[model samples]
Target: MSARFGRLRRVLAVLLTAVACQSPPAVRAAAPPGPAARASGVVTWAASADRMGEGTAGQGYRLVVHTSVGGSDLRVRFTNAFGDRPLTLDGVYAGLRARGAALRPGSNRPLTFGGARTVTVPAGAVAWSDPLPGRIPAGTDLVVSLHTPDAAGPATGHWMAMQTSYTGRGGHTAEESGANWTQTTGSWWYIDSVAVRPSRAARGAVVALGDSITDGWHSTTDLDRRWPDYLARRLHAAGAPVQGVADEGISGNQVLADGAGQAALHRLDRDVLSQPGVRTVFLFEGVNDIKAHTGVTAAELVDGYREIARRAHAAGVCVVAATVAPFKGWPEWDPAAEAVRQEVNRFLRGSPDFDAVTDFDRVLRSPYDPERILPFFDGGDHLHPDDKGMQAMADAVDLDSLDCAR
Candidate 1:
């Protein structure tokens, strides 16, 4: 027994010595690609794509976006979903926003596509940049600069960004100074989604799929006062498992028809399911369908909700449906539309197709009338909410409901 003990001690001593003498392993700057990495990556920010007039040659866009989750190995996606010809973006850079059209010094970095500096996305397709090696913090104002050398035909973008972005002529994308970016636009061009590899492998994202309210029409511009923004801050503060939020809302968007941005049903795959690491889709639309008086019955609207839930479930994603809020004071509001809204809200509350439901209608409806929006929350249009109401909507969301798995 003594001999055996001595031998074991000597072996352990030699192993320790060898380990101590060897150099430490090099730290990897970027996460390796695999099923694990793929699952861990989440969309930190997103906006739905739509046709935004014609793209001009030699035009550069310095688009500003707000991030929800911080992580490394950042990637940006550009789309040409409505273009008639291939879209070539020659110079693309990502940086931290210092001010209007200006990027933080030393924060601007060139983005590449498969090691190439330039990429041309085909019409009706999207392109993702190779991961940039760095960390971006949550709640950051990220600026994406890109130049189109020969852009023409229909340009794909989000027209109502609710945030300011800058445009320039020629190849001024690499400049960090705001001087070159003299023109201002309230839209985001080319880029639609920004993703990152989160530190926690279990961290995931929720995409808010909705209309103008979700698009933040009435919220204060450049303040990040959107309901999703408020929700993101809440998630971060609470240390929730789902730390990422992607707002896939479009102004005047509908759930059943292709008027505003190719109806929620038609663009579901591209706007929601295709997003990486999305675990839940928060559906809060359908007011337009009811108010438009296009003869869309409550049954038809309910069917659309079911289809959305079914498709999301098939892709291993959960769905949380929000009832359409009151909008009685709007010009389109009438007894017929009010009846339809009530029926649809009832369906949303009781639907088994959804994993959970949020009663935005109850929150926004006035105590005096229930069908009219609460006077305090109204943004004067009776359809949208102000910043305070936006916060209230965010607060009403039970964060746990958004943390479910497939």
Candidate 2:
């Protein structure tokens, strides 16, 4: 027993020393690819023209995105995803907003782009800020003060999946964008998420391109319930890590380039390959493509999925392919579609376009009916999963599979 114990202690000592000597992943300061034409996020809030009294100058909205850590030049996107007409020109500001933990208002600072203080965002368009001298510390709340010219009516924000939180100037007041019973869904407006890149060591973003599932629908709002959040949570938990997950999963987006949104292939480089720290792409798209294009055969969808994998892989990003979950008797589900899904799924099971496979479909779909989904896991719509189901899907991914690429 003494001999065995001594050997074990030596092994443990060596392991501890190795861990102590380890360093954070190398983060090179390099300019990465992004949207060529230029696009950004907008503040889409349900604007009540009634709210516009004599006090209109301060009535408009401002948006801010928070970074994982603070310090460095960062880029921003302002979008108006829920407007009927062109959202007029207005001013935007990015600055530090105090968390309840902070004590004073003197900490706020205005963000500027290219020496300009204002921008005009066309309807359904996004305006991105040129890299600014914004210093974002980790876990710090970012206050995006949007000085609207007037009331910007009912606005929706992207990257605010599963609900998000906001703190007023005083910091005591708190509100969530996903509140069920609000006078107006004013909360959803005002801002999109903020992403940060280290000007010194950061490479770029690892754009997590996918559908609603990847967008983290049904995950607890304000609590950060998206699977990407789960994935991000995992990354942070890692003793020392590399890269970050920049979620670009637009809800209702599709492949083959159609009405839902830019198709997967159409926006592959834009959404996935364009992000910073994007040495990898974890793709879980295509259920919508199959359902929305039922008449389309499995072979075609399989071909498209392979193309997505190939494109990302070509860009030096290790691709991770996720299986599409089952959908039996839903609004979008059709027998023919199910057949096609099955065929495509089979091909994805052992394909090489992907560096690895994250079987989100296999883990959640019911055993009794491969086509029909399990009742417990299905959201009432039968298409999307409930929060629990979403978590299960996220949990199904194998973190080890991504290590080689990292």
Best by lDDT: 1
The CA lDDT of each predicted structure is: 0.86, 0.53
**Alpha-carbon runs more than 4 Å astray in model 1:** 1-40
Give TM-scores for every candidate, taking all chains together and pairing residue i with residue i: 0.90, 0.69
Q: Compared to the true structure, candidate 1 yields what TM-score?
A: 0.90
Question: Candidate 2 local accuracy as lDDT?
Answer: 0.53
The residue pairs that clash in candidate 1, if any, are none
> On residues 58-103, what C-alpha lDDT tens digit does candidate 1 reach at each position?
9999999999989999999888888878999988999999989988
Report each candidate's C-alpha RMSD, comma-separated, in the order given.
Answer: 18.9, 15.0
For candidate 2, the clash count comes to: 38
Measured on C-alpha atoms, candidate 1 has an lDDT of 0.86
